[model samples]
Target: MVNLVVTLRKKSQGIWRSSFVRSVAVVASGTAGAQAVTIAFAPLITRLYGPEAYGVQGAFISIMSVAAPIGALAYPISVVLPRRDEEALGLLRLSAYISFFIAALIAVGLWLGGEAVISLLEIESISTLIYLLPVAVLFAAWKQMAERWLIRKKAFGVIARSALANSGFLNSARALAGFVYPSGAVLIVLATVAEVLHALLMLIGIRKRTTIDLSESSEVSTSNVIELAHRHRDFPLYRAPQNTINAASKSLPVLMLATFFGPSTAGFYMLSQMVMGMPSTLVGKAVSDVFYPRITEAAHNGENLSRHILRATGSLAAIGIVPFAIVIFFGPWMFSLVFGEEWSMAGEYARWLALFFFFNFINKPSNAAVPVLGIQRGLLFYEILSTGGKVVGFLLGFYWLNSDIWAVAIFSVVGVIAYSGVMLWVYLCAVRWDRDKKAV
Candidate 1:
């Protein structure tokens, strides 16, 4: 502990000393800190809002989650690709512009065809609140774009702070607001507030870090932005659909559960996903955000990245084993104790999800290879397969097995297999990239 403190102090003094470690620490610390707050408030949140209300909130989130990724046209993802900040800035503007149009389209569609949408999705509970999807998409997509710009700048510290601020404000708003309105609609409003706040914080961070980033001094124009868009066109063409499907697949358990079993089941599933997914989403995300830029740098300079990939996978796998084991073993008792008797079912779901999350954690950082190595078309195929896997897993469980537990269990099993395939594919791609770079 004493040595660790000294090391951290040195890190704080010289953040550039070890870029990868520093970046990971900043992002991981921020994510873990924010998630800790969410966990700390879970009891109060669960008690105040209850499972059914959470289910309602979860369904709406599921809808926006799918839309937000596509709304940005996935351009922000390639922001790290451009060597010049000018090109990056152009991509940023392009992504933001697309996001605005997507949000507007969603709002207009809802205004004109809200009833049709409700009937089509068989979701009447959130019909009144469906209009808020546009707001959610707009704010969330813009936040993603802003965050991507920071990532391009290697501003992990800024990104980390933003994560803490964003999650804290968002979750707090949801928790505190539950006491007042205590409806699912209130959660949506609070979420919109949090997303807008997070985006503003990121914008402020960008401005404070470098006036040049905020400046038109870069001379990015409509044609320049269009050129960059055409250059990374595959991102929007291939990656957007892939990401949307992946997100929609992730959202399905909630929607399917709510539609088939009821809101309480979906709520239980959402809580289960939240609790089990924390380590992967929090820490793996930190590693991935850092790794994406680092790998880009490596590929740019013809450097080998296999060692780095192996080290990351090993470290995440090691860190994940213990916590996930505990979740799988004692999930039910802990959920009952922490979240109340109503959430005990969520623990069962958590146990079933443990293997899937473990694989997912190992896979998250490696996912950068698709973008970095330009193997997105293949990745798109994988996404389709995995999305089908998830949907089919749930459907099989629901219809064939006639058991919710079986449904989730099959989904988790399929997820583990799908993630393992993706991890292997990325490893192969990284290896091939290294070999080809060396041969040159």
Candidate 2:
């Protein structure tokens, strides 16, 4: 009996190790490909679009950000932990339908609320918001859901290739539009169209890979969705609050900058975010793409889930933090040189935000592990406190002192650190609980 147990343990360990390798290979390749396409286009986008265009894009990005969770309606979380083929397809269809409906509503809302959105962003015109519907928000949501679905299916190659193709199309369209239209307004419109084109391509790629047959199976009903929601009830229950806090915390400062500092200063800040976000988002997202699915698979046994989570946290931290430090030191000058002299101030903003991004990079993957381990309530509590802290910081910076740009910068750095600290504590506590439970 002892000999048999030893052999079984060895086999289990080997299987886990293999799964780790496969997960890393797939996620890394996809993330690296995405980073490549986005990074390669950075110079051209900056040169052609300019800072004001970037500021507008950033504002639009904030509004469109709501589209993802709204359209997905918790489907990303569902995809990460589907227990059966039927469950996976059900969630997939529900997510698509939810996304389409929400996108249409949002597009129409944007059309009606164009003036309000433009005024809120402090831009001079609503023209950009008017066209933001079909080209930008809807397509952007489609692309995100498609990407999440691809991750669920473990189709990394499809993701990589589509990212490249999408980037190529977007840049090419922007270039042509700039040459012919000359107005920034037209270029923004064209970019939205490009995003739709990108989504269409990803959809084609997804269809080829997954065997999702809705016709043969019984239709997923309202009760089915509600049941699915109840099945993974912890997702939006825990994730939604955390996501809302994090999203609001991140966006609030940018919104304040736009409100007080004007679009040009906001433009500079936007550039900084775009630069620092690449690494943070890339590493965190890649690890998450693997971590959620794997941890979910292992969750029935606490010991297995804990080991996987810790292993992932370590790998993600090591890879994510080192480059973050290097970027912090060299980031300002790199920004100036890369983005041109007009964007020199962006370098200053970059330096501060880099620290925030680094902390975020270090902590985000670990936070992602919580939901998979069934400890999302802890994360929710942390985000609640962190969001309160962020709001206080924002008020102190913007309202009390009336320091515009610097206030925004300081708030970002401090808010991220505070948020990361809480997240770390929660993750560690969850890890300890798993260990103790395993001992029992």
TM-score of each candidate structure, all chains considered together: 0.94, 0.85
Error of 1 at 257 (Å): 0.5
Provide the overall lDDT of each model, using Cα atoms, as 2-decimal numbers.
Answer: 0.85, 0.68
Summing lDDT over every window of 10 consecutive residues in candidate 2, give the lowest-scoring window.
63-72
lDDT of 1 at 188: 65
**lDDT of each residue in 8-61, candidate 2, tens digit only:** 999878866896566756666666666776677676667776777677666656
Clash pairs (backbone) in predicted model 1: none
Tens digit of lDDT per residue, candidate 1, span 163-267? Answer: 888888888887778888787768767776787888889888988884454676358988888888888999988999999988898898998998888877888
